[model samples]
Target: MLLKLDLTDSRPLHEQVAGAIRRAIAEGECAPGDRLPPARELSRALGVNANTVLRGLRALRDEGVLEFRRGRGVTVLAGADQRARLVDQAGALLAEATRLGYSRADLVELIRRLP
Candidate 1:
């Protein structure tokens, strides 16, 4: 998997790691049932701590984009491509709303008001 972190990005390292993996999934770098490189391997490649990589992986798993299996490693989940895309879009929306001085609750309200 090709994971790229923007050194200029101000987000937390773990978030950057997660974003990179999310992008990889959205771009088809890996597919459902595909095993991911170990956290240590990813940390070495990204020059971050292994814990940071694991945290990122956990975040992806929480978002339903990846799955963790005992002795089987991490695998991309089915429909991950679409899930990743929605995550990207939601992140963009949140960023825009924050920039516009709207709180997350306000964003939620806006969505609720939508048809």
Candidate 2:
């Protein structure tokens, strides 16, 4: 769910963080059974309060998009296969990049994947 921030955007940092996490979940960038960073950590990273992270998480949980356990923390609801799901979802990204004249190397650099 975590991604780079858009320094130029007018959106609030917390909203951006929440949106990124939401998109990741929707697109399978974060898979079922995946665990999110703790609220304090995310807040520190995003330069926001822990309560902001908590609100975002609670909103997602209320939407049935994530499960938050009191002590164990937050985890994606496990069922979908991470690899296959991401592969399918990434097809659109690949095509869009091609349409925009981006090479695989350029995409790799821009995305800068964790692994």
Across residues 31-99, which tens digit of lDDT does each residue of candidate 1 receive? 988999999999999999999999999999999999999999999999999999999999999999999
Report, for every candidate in turn, its global Cα lDDT versus the true structure.
Answer: 0.96, 0.71
lDDT of 2 by residue, 4-104 (tens): 66758776665566556767776768888888999899888877788977887776676566788888889877643443345435655876898899987
As a TM-score, model 1 comes out at: 0.98
Question: How far off is residue 10 in model 1, in Å?
Answer: 0.9
- Which pairs clash in model 1? none
| Model 1: worst 10 consecutive residues (lDDT sum) | 1-10
Candidate maximizing TM-score: 1
Candidate 1 lDDT: 0.96
